[model samples]
Target: MKTALIALTTATFVGTAAFAAVADLDSDGDGVVSFTEMLASYPTLTEEGFSAIDTNGDGVVDEEEMTAATEGGLIPEA
Candidate 1:
């Protein structure tokens, strides 16, 4: 049980770290992620793909959008 708990905790930490890494890519610190900023981190992602993630036609991906994309497997699970 202890081992499982430790593993869960570690996974949570790693997931949070990954999210933070992506969040840190917001060079402008606009509280939202722009395509250019996301592209800087994920070179393989295209503008169209980013559009899908943006979800609200806002031209930016906010934290809720990012979380939904990640959770729904629209983006890779971290």
Candidate 2:
């Protein structure tokens, strides 16, 4: 049990770090990630791919959307 817990904690930390790495690309820190910011981290991101991940049609990808996209493999893992 202890080993499992430790593994889980490590995984969580790794995932959080990856998320933060991507979030840090938000150069403007506007709480939403713009296409330019996304592209900074993912040079291969296309207009269609970004639009698909934006989901809400808000022209920016929020944390929730980014999480979903990463988990769903729509975007490369950070």
Candidate 3:
């Protein structure tokens, strides 16, 4: 029973980590992740999608915006 519980816990942790990795916005394999990269990688992003990512409303995506977008899970996985 203890072994089973440990296995379940380990599985849950691994699953969570995998999901987090998938949700990460750094899809381009580049050191600096951005919403533009996300859009390029996932072409399904529309104007609304861009708007959702441009948290600062500067009309351009920066690192902070990208980080926010990534943390918010607004960008899709690579």
lDDT of each: 0.77, 0.81, 0.64
Candidate maximizing lDDT: 2
| Steric overlap count per candidate | 0, 0, 0
Residue-wise lDDT of candidate 3 within 1-78, one digit each (tens)? 999999999867755654454346456554343546556667787778878877777665655556566667886655
| Alpha-carbon shift of residue 1 in model 2 (angstroms) | 14
Give the winner by TM-score: 2
Candidate with the larger lDDT of 1 and 2? 2
Off by over 4 Å in 1: 1-22, 76-78
Pull out the clashing pairs in model 1. Answer: none
Please provide, for model 2 over 1-78, each residue's C-alpha lDDT reduced to its tens digit, 9 standing for 90 to 100: 999999999868767755685568779867678988888878888999999999999898877777778778898544
TM-score of each model, in listed order: 0.67, 0.70, 0.48
Judged by whole-model lDDT over C-alpha atoms, candidate 1 comes out at 0.77
- Candidate 1 residue-wise lDDT, 1-78, digit = tens: 999999999868766754675578678977778988887777788888898998999898877777767776666332
Which of the two, 1 or 2, has more TM-score? Answer: 2
